[model samples]
Target: MVTGLTLLHTSPAHVPVFDALRDREHPGAVLRHLVYPELLERARAHGPESVAEDLRGLLGDAGGPVLVTCSTLGAVAEALAPALGAPVLRVDRPMAAEAVRTGPRIAVLATVESTLAPTAELLAEEADGRPVSVRTRLVEGAWELFVAGGTARHLAAVAEAVDAVTDADVIVLAQASMAGAAPLARTRVPVLSSPGPGLAAALRLCGADTTAAPPA
Candidate 1:
């Protein structure tokens, strides 16, 4: 079994994305969820590193390499990288890079306020001094729908939020949980999700080819 670790601020939003990527390498892989208390808003205020340490403590002795997933925990992930000695699956970096590459006017949508700085920094770095304009917005109360089992409704609200940031060439869902709403966010704009690049990187780091499905 190919086991991994995921830190979820809400319900199983990251699970489907991970499962989709896992199926390409380890079909029916057993996923271990390290559920931390809902830290969406708190993550920004308290810092993600502390939360990551809390998660690391929760994952005691669960062997095999692990991948930590978080949309708002980039700083925490960077801090935890050395300790975990495993690839930390931060959703913002790649998504930001992709958004910058696609367009100058980028819209970043997130539930947490802390995600903006790191995301903006990453986009600026990827733009290579090019005059790329970035616009960011926050969507409050959307993650609640996912926790209430209203995945579709939550996604639609996210799409509506993305639509609110009009005249942008690309839209980036800063939260991994927000990734499930990508299909609905297709409004004449390219919507990028963390799972696509994050999972691809995870597979490569695990020495697996992402092209073929994992063994059943």
Candidate 2:
């Protein structure tokens, strides 16, 4: 039986994305995916705090080292870690930390408006007193395309937004869904995505050996 990491996501699209990542990074590893689309709807309709009760209930059955793939709920997941009695990780954290270490000027690109604040806040926390500047850009209409199952168009829009940010030392893709846009972005600045780094962290947290995984 293959047992490794458990992922909590607000969208079903993430299932394939992370599944593919695991196949490439940790071949033959098994992953459990728990997607709750309503969680995101409720969070966006209300606020991050409003999802706390629902999240707590949902996470009650989740296994350790659960990776929350929604950027808007990243902070809440981290906050609930202690109470959850399991390792709850936000997908963007590892990417945010890496962005902080990469350069002083960081450009964060997101499709969802709610993702902007959480991502920027996480980046600042990762900076840890370092003199780093973060600029956030929301790709207009990209989320609608993604919701309508237009993956290619959504990626192209995000890539265009990435290319528009000319003053950044590094570009950070705020949402895991935005990872696909990284390679499509035609820019000199390094584009950092969450899945690779987030999966690595999830494996570590779950006590899975990552020696065979490719270098980041």
Candidate 3:
């Protein structure tokens, strides 16, 4: 029995993206959620090592590949890489590279403040002093909409936020929670969702080519 693992922050905004990917691969695979409001509250309260331990515990003895998704949890995945002993996908890196390649002006929208640092660092490194212009903004109340069962509202807010960043050539939605908002995030620029890249990476890690058509 092959199993695939993926982690989501306590937010349900990621449901659509995860559900879509899961239906494509393992229809009934288990999904683990790690909630740490305290850890997420403070900017420097914890690091990846602490988050990784929580992940290992939540994913106890699950024998399969794991794909972790979180804008603020990338460092956590990095810390857990040694322990999980399986392929871990950090959703932002690929998106960052894609953003850099798209053009000079890149706009990143995220709900959490923690995501800003790593995202900026990743983009800077990927840009490699190409004089790329990077701008970031926090979607002030979008996450609350997700928690309050207002997914559509959240998507609308995200679209509005993206629209506000019209100067960008490409927009990167940093949080997986923001994935559902991708389709609604109408922009003259390209909107890159974490799930697309994350799912692609997960398929590659599992050695599965998801490029095939879905069942009729």
User: Quick one: best TM-score, which candidate?
Assistant: 2
In candidate 3, stretches whose alpha carbon ends up further than 4 angstroms from where it belongs are 1-5, 24-50, 56-62, 128-130, 214-216
Q: Rate the local accuracy (lDDT) of all candidates.
A: 0.67, 0.88, 0.70
lDDT tens digits by residue: candidate 3, 9-113: 544445556777766765654455444554454433665455656666654454555565666767566556566676666767778888899998988898767
Using Cα atoms with residue i matched to residue i, what is each candidate's TM-score against the true structure?
Answer: 0.78, 0.95, 0.79
lDDT leaderboard ranking: 2, 3, 1
lDDT of 2 by residue, 90-159 (tens): 9989999999989999988888888999998999999999999888888999999999999999999999
C-alpha lDDT (0 to 100) for residue 84 of candidate 2 = 80
Model 1 per-residue lDDT tens digits across residues 141-210 = 7766767778888888888897777798988888787887777765878988887676666555555554
Alpha-carbon runs more than 4 Å astray in model 1: 1-10, 24-32, 38-45, 55-65, 213-216
Model 2, residue 42: distance off in Å is 1.3
Model 2 lDDT at residue 77: 78
Best by lDDT: 2
